[model samples]
Target: MSFEQFLFYFFSVVLVGAAVAMITVRNPVHAALFLVLAFFTSAAHWIMLEAEFLGILLVLVYVGAVMVLFLFVVMMLDINVARVREGFVRLLPVGLVVAVGMMVVMAMVVGARVFQVESPGRADGDYSNTKAIGELLYTEYVYPFEIAAVILLVAIIAAITLTLRRRPDSLYMDPAEQIKVQRKDRVRLIKMEAEKK
Candidate 1:
């Protein structure tokens, strides 16, 4: 086997293992870490396929940014693992069925070569995947790209709206109240009567 094939097999094994561990691990933090490993291996696969831009993006966006945020949220939150696991056994069969169905569909898609395209000539040093993707995104797929951006924006807003809560016990300062404050209101001079020592 060629070195490239060996690297592909090694990464593929690691990717699958990481994905399984991500799902099966009891600790949410460990799961997130496993997901990071999975993302890294997937990026390696992309790089092997000569899609360097996508591989770098996958690492920077998912592993560096999203996974770090996920880890922080998981670590900071008070989660009851027992309560979360309570329904796992009950849902195992359903999950397995869905997983199997997905695998079958993926296998069929691969076997059929539904998306097979004519292999282009090997890339020259001047070829750039990022530029090509950017041109397509801004030109042919502009509308769809804009729509996806809007959808992501809405989702972010919705998440913030859902998680935001105000507690009466917590201290809060209203911007309007602060703006309305005057020097006289903030300071009051008190006159004291003289006392004998």
Candidate 2:
């Protein structure tokens, strides 16, 4: 096998192992870190395909932003591993079924040689990856992209909503109440008794 083929197999093993570790790890924070490893390997695969933009985007958007956020949430939440694992035995069958079904579908698509390979060619001299992506995103795929954005926005709002709490004993000044206050409200004339301290 070629060096590239060997590298591909090596990273592919690492990617799958990391993914499995992400799911099976007892600690949520450790799981999240393994998930980062999975993302890194996937990005490496994309880079090997010469999709530099997509590889960088995968590293930047997923590994940088989304995975960091996931890791932070996992760490901050202090999730009970025992409680989470309680139902794992009951859910194992379903998980196995779903995994098997996905594997079958993937095999059908890929193992059947539906994707024919062409000889490697030199990179197009005039091709611009960013421009092509921009055109596709803004023109044909704009609606789907916008929908994804809205979904992400809603997810962010939902996460904040779920985590936010109010302290009943803590006093806070109302902005509207402050704005509506008059000079009389601000300054109270007090009659004080003069006393020797």
Candidate 3:
């Protein structure tokens, strides 16, 4: 077998193992780490497929940023691993069925490709994937893309609104009020007689 084939199989195995570990690991932090490993393996697979831009993006965005945030959040959370695991025994049969169903579906889809006509030629590399994606987003999919962005923006605003509170006892400053304040509002001058020693 070629080196590429070997690398592909190696990455695929690692990716699947990591994905399974991410779900089964008792420790939340360990689960997050496994998820990161899965992401990295998937990125490596993308690289093997000649999708260099997507591979780098997956590593940078998911592994570097998202997984780091996930690790921190999972570490900070007061999760009860035992309690979470309690349902696993009951859920295992259903989970296994779902997993097997997915595997079967994937196998069918992949296996059917042998009978389909293959498209010729590779996509031009002159334009980066990011540029092509952006072009497509802004041109063909602009409305849907903008709608999704608006939905995400609304969700962010909702989260902030839900979490934000006005605490009467807490000292806080308003930037707008600070910016509008005159020197007199913040400063005071006093005259006092000197104390005799």
Number of clashes recorded per candidate: 0, 0, 0
Give the alpha carbon lDDT tens digit for every residue of 1-197 in model 2.
99999999999999999999988877888888998999999999988987779989999999999988997777788678889989888899999999999999998888665476663444768776667678979999999999999999999999999978788997888999989989997899999999999
Q: What lDDT does the true structure give each of the candidates? A: 0.93, 0.88, 0.87
Global fold similarity of model 1 (TM-score): 0.88
- Name the candidate, 1 or 3, with the larger TM-score value: 1
List candidate 3 segments past 4 Å from native.
104-147, 167-171, 174-192
RMSD of 3: 3.7
Ranking the candidates on lDDT from highest down gives 1, 2, 3
TM-score of each: 0.88, 0.77, 0.75
Model 1 per-residue lDDT tens digits across residues 110-197: 8886468665456678877788789979999999999999999999999999988998798988999999999999999999999999
Candidate with top lDDT is: 1
Better-scoring candidate (TM-score), 1 or 2: 1
RMSD of 1: 2.2
Residue-level lDDT tens digits of model 3 in 1-197: 99999999999999989999989888888888899889989999888866788999999999889888888888888898889989988999999999999999988987896657563346665756567668878999999999999999999999999989988998998999889999898899999999999
lDDT of 3 at 138: 98
